[model samples]
Target: MPMRTRDSSGRRLATLAVCCAIVVLVLAAVAMPVAGHAYLSDSDPANGDRLEALPETVTLEFSGDGVQVADVTVTGPDGEDVSGDAVIDPDDDRLVSVSLERDDTDADGIYTVDWEILAEDGHTTAGSFFFSVGDEPVDRESVLEAYADDEDDVSIATTAAKGALLLAVVALVGVPVTAAVAVYPVVGRFGVAPSVVDRRLTRVLAGAGVVLFGAVLALGVARSASIGSSGLSLEAIRTFAATPLGHVWLVQLLVAALVATGLLAGVRGSLDRRYWLGSSLAGAVVVQATVSWTSHSATLVDRLQGVTVDFAHVAGAGLWLGGLCVLAAVLPTVLADAEAGDRDRLAADAIRRYSIVALTGVTLALLTGLILAVWHAPTLAHLAETTYGTALSAKVLLVVAALGLGGFTRFVLLRRLDPDRERSALERRVRGRGSSGRGSDGRVRENGGREAGDDPTVDETASTTSTLVTRVLSLEVALLVLVVVLSGLLTSTPTAVVAEQTDAGDPVTLEREYDDGIVELTVGSPSVWGEHGSAFVDEGEPVVFDVTFTSASDGDPLESDRPVTILAHNERADTQLQFDLEATEEPGTYSTVQTLPDPLWWELRVSGSPEGTYVSEWVDVYAVPDGHEHVHEYAPLEETGFTHLLRIGAIVVGITGSLAVAVETVRFGRRQR
Candidate 1:
């Protein structure tokens, strides 16, 4: 009995260790930064600085990871905007140069310089600086421009750094959590010593946590460097350390230490319940806090939603991955033991238990994942067309593969090959045969020693089978880690700065008004130009209708009748308005209003023809806002059709399936003896 127990304990320990290792590796890989073009640093003129002469041009220096800018702009002191011919520096694609037209900037007033650069990450960052030409003095424009520049500078670095940090933490915590829940039942059914398994698992978790913490610190340093900070200062450190997020990181470090201590104690056969609980709670808290900071949990409603979903995601992941670890590590060791019968029973039980837990974990993960995806994405197009959407799709595919593997293990391998009652009967028969005076093929027992070449003992076969299962499960666990890491990356905003560069353009507006029973329209476009044509509204012809209404006792129009109209006109075409008008039936005073079909310049003719005629006003409808140059036309829903619905349905189904599997696994574990 003692020997059998020891073998079981060793197997359990091995299983937990493997599970923890897989989690660590997955999280680390997810945290690794993708190699791409990026802006390493930048130097622009300080805002509100006084210069003796107008510089020939504004120069912007940046490091690109893999992106290039097509143009840059400079708005002069006289409100004359100039765009320099943009070119990549000969030395590096990362560096770009723009040449502004040299104008006499000798006047002593403030000038605004704006730069638009494409980051290697495929996002665009734009900012402006203000400097005084000549030696006049500082003014309101200079101060406002200087302040704006400072705000932009701070925003860019802070947002990027925070985003990166959040991504890292999610990957690190998600993998192990997923694996533990998935394989929990298998680990439990193995009948391995819980103490040994817990000890090894704790050690793995602690060690990995510490390593990840160090990696995070290193990442912070790298981010700072990218932001052009040469050396860390007390203020900088304080800025990071004083925040709620900083406290979370500190807690993570502390939890890692506690986990290490707990593992050490368990290994020494001095495991304390308080220490174990404390470590687990602390570790969980750290993960939770990190999620709050990294996710959209800053707002009250979002916080509630995020916390719930994030917790579910983490817990489900841990249960699946952790259980897998225990199964993989211990199964081989148990199978190698001399007591082959016990090994067989243990392996069978473990597999059964793990299968159930894994199913449940998957189910929960799927459900919560769906909710999160919907909440974050909001629209079907975002899920299918955006970078985040594509990554999510990949994650779903991986999950499906994992689930299929799990199903095969449960239905074919466990249920068919290792039915509990069938295995018990076989064990009884083997024992009876060995106890009886039976030899190979029912012959006399001449030598008395079991024939070495004869049928192997039940225990031996069970151990071998267990070992094989462990190997297979280990592979599954590895794949799961990959999924978790990919998930972390997916949660981040995938639209990079470089991609935003192409989207920069001008603004256009469309406006129409009905006054004194006539429809009038106006269209305006910004002077700025881009590839897209400016927005222009055109109408067919003014359709006239009238509304009659009564005046109130207070002399105000009681029942005012108004019409909708659209007036359309382009720069090269004559403008016209199509109008729909309604008449009011109120007594004492009646009025009529009309609407134009298009937005453009139009004349409204209001007449009580040959009796009471009142002509009241011509209004210009502006199509575009001043200083903007372009507008995006909205595509009707018919254009996209049911593609969006299909995508959304798929996401929902995938998430639901994962949840169902996870729940079933947990119930199976609870029912197991």
Candidate 2:
């Protein structure tokens, strides 16, 4: 093929690849599983309630799976602990309760219920609320004044430890897999005895294993410190090892130790070299899988599917990023030692083989990354508004940059080392194209054999291509490392939905009588925007107004013939919105779903008709707290039948792509052997 034609063809191919990648990402965003740690959903003797009498127990409910009560304490007005140990409900894992202790003089002032919960996904969340036992309404500010709510401090050291652990995991998994799939096979095929290279690789693998082992240990210590303890103590480690997170930590420690031992055994020649290498590679994959289980994926209803996709995502990353580091570290030495006559041939063959592995890695990383992004962030609004979404966006951009660099290396730089084109260069020389006897790649050839430094132009061109490849590779590796660090942060960060839920404090209630001694209305304020209260509802999510009507004369429940409606007016924004209430199974009680438009104070009235038929006095309420501005007008697209199918299809594609790479690796290893 003509030089111009080949160049144009390569460009076209690169463009097509990028377009296909974009389409795949679009498809993967169709619908993702809502996977986040548990958040408080509802509570009995609810927050900010003024009770006629104290209930026997205070129960808390959550919206996530595998919830375990870490701590629950109820303090009386005198600041005395009045609750027994918190126990998970026998029927529902999401529910936990504590029995309250009452005296003859049951405190009439405010009582605070503080709680902490641990989800199986390795995260802890805690919150507090206040309720009173007398007729007087307690100001929220008073509750804050009387009892200082302790905020959980996020340890920076813990975050750093997590990042280090992730880096080590990627390196450990990548080194052996790259050696087996790319380096070993290609060099063997080139008739290059890789004994020296093998020794160096074994040392590298051993070092990675050591790092992995140490990282696992450091992560445990950091985890202990985050839980409010000096992690240096054995008791602290033992305490951490007793929780659900501790169980996973134990598995990680075991895997890291076993993999390190296997690699070391192979290095010392005490074990079957091939057997240990293969075992260690598989162990590395297990470590990667364990890491996924500790992420938000662990909270998914389809936990197995979520973890499988997550594992594939990181494994693919390890293959690509680790392989690049391996190539950059080892390939230079191999090339420098090659015979001058065979250097070009060996370089071409080895790089070409490694290119296939790299392509597979990129493909898996891109596809699975799309699945993971949607799973974690759901909507574009979430991506723009939430911390987790922002980090994910940054990672996606870095991946794209890495992809571009890889494509440039494969199509532009690697093409210069094509061995088959040596004959074509000689043919061109005979045809008098140029006396230089050079190929289109600017490499000199003597009767189908490369001759080093024969032409200054050829030498300079080769030098330039080599320099470009090295620069691109270095940048790509750096970007990928940053991507991994972000991934670690994401694994620890709460999803946007969870963050909103956590921010939403307890519900506030207001009651009023307004019908000339005929009827009464009580409203439990609903907020779609999360503030520092309970019952957090998200924008576009259903905001439930829990209300009841009672006959003032007899103190009996009153049922209205017509459904009740609430009209809310925000004086600040001059916005008026109305919603009709639906009757629940409870008599005289009605609930309605509405979404607040902004976080502003609003006056609400309950009525049965539109024209001044107000049954209750206008009551003041904050639909959403001040300063929490609206970020989006619409909610994320919920899963439809079609989107569900699309999600399933994406998962299948990810799994299939990963399996194809695994098969290729096995084939390469066998052939090289």
Which candidate number would show the highest lDDT if scored against the true structure? Answer: 2
TM-score for each model: 0.52, 0.70
Candidate 2 residues 380-435, lDDT tens each? 66678888879888988998888888878877777675534534554566457443
Which regions of candidate 2 are displaced past 4 Å? 1-32, 89-91, 142-154, 228-233, 265-272, 422-468, 500-637, 640-673
The 0-to-1 C-alpha lDDT of every candidate, in the order given, reads: 0.44, 0.64
Residues 536-573 of candidate 1 have per-residue lDDT tens digits of 32132111122232222333333332332323333333
Best by TM-score: 2
**Which pairs of residues clash in candidate 2, taking residues 3 or more apart in a chain or in different chains?**
504-533, 505-533, 505-534, 506-533, 506-534
Worst 10 residues of 1 by lDDT: 520-529
